[model samples]
Target: MPEKVKTDLGFADLQCRKSDVGRISRIAKAAYSFNRRFFGKEIKKPFHIIICYSRKEFDDIWGAETDAWLTGFATKTGTIVSFRDDLIRKYNPRKEATLAGTLRHEINHIFYFQIYGSYEPAWLLEGLTLQPPFEPFTLMENDKKRLKGPLPHLIYSTNGKTFFKQAPFLYSMAFLATRH
Candidate 1:
């Protein structure tokens, strides 16, 4: 088992396995830089970043059987990022980019939650968070395709099962509408 290490970024704090310190730091730096450049400042409130080293660890901590498909998520208070050690050991040039992207996505959620004081549509939330081409106000081919489907009118009160079931399509549509 790997030992845990924690680093404070002032605006955010990171806790991850010792072996993953360098990668987590790089991701944090990139996320902070991106937020500063675009948002004009660091996040207004401090948040926690918990990084798990394996699927089991992530599930255990989050209490969700995310099945490794979810690399991370954010809440009003913080973000959770995961990197399966076995997966990282494999050669992949895009790994860092993916991690940084996830961090950026989560950070945007936290920022928006604080600023708006209420949750926005999933598409708007994710679109704003996703990287360029899918950035806040930009539309992509997928977003256009998603617009043709049934769209959710309200963002609240949907049951958990229904919300999870419709998440992918609904978020895509929301992103398209936001762009428009």
Candidate 2:
């Protein structure tokens, strides 16, 4: 197994396994490429991303940060991403969700950091970042069951912070909002 160390927000570690390293590298590159196209110009700085395989390593690297439920985090210094070996072993034995979801999700956060230096409103930032023209956003097609088609108008009338509490509700709204 690859080593992981605790960091301020989660785990901090390097990806050493050939396959894991390759996957992270590929996704990070895709994130950068997507950001460049979204902005219509190349972002000059290179991103530094750190990965960890276990909660202990994540806690060790995360140090004393208080927020819980943080599966991963992105900062200017680097991005810390976490995944449980148990989850992989029990559920995603094939590694599909690891690459398709966590990898892309955190990397998109990194790209958002580069695009907007300060923490923007969670709604605008998360909404725009999670929406289309982004590569990972396109992967939503693969999870059809998760999509509840054509959200009700009442959902969009509410604030993002409120609706997002119910992720399925928020996703339906997102789909509705993005459409013409």
Top TM-score model:
1
Against the true structure, candidate 2 reaches a TM-score of 0.54
RMSD to the native, candidate 2? 7.1
What are the models' TM-scores?
0.74, 0.54
Name the 10 consecutive residues with the lowest summed lDDT in model 1.
88-97
Candidate 2 C-alpha error for residue 74, in Å: 0.8
Predictions in order: lDDT = 0.63, 0.49
Q: Write the per-residue lDDT of candidate 2 for residues 1-180, one digit (tens) a residue.
A: 745332221222344344566555555566556655666665445554565565566667667442343455565575545553344334342344444355455655665666677444443444555565542343244335455564344243233346335544444345435543
Per-residue lDDT tens digits for candidate 1, residues 40-78, read: 655577888887667777677666676334566676555
User: Can you list the residue pairs that collide in candidate 1?
Assistant: 123-175
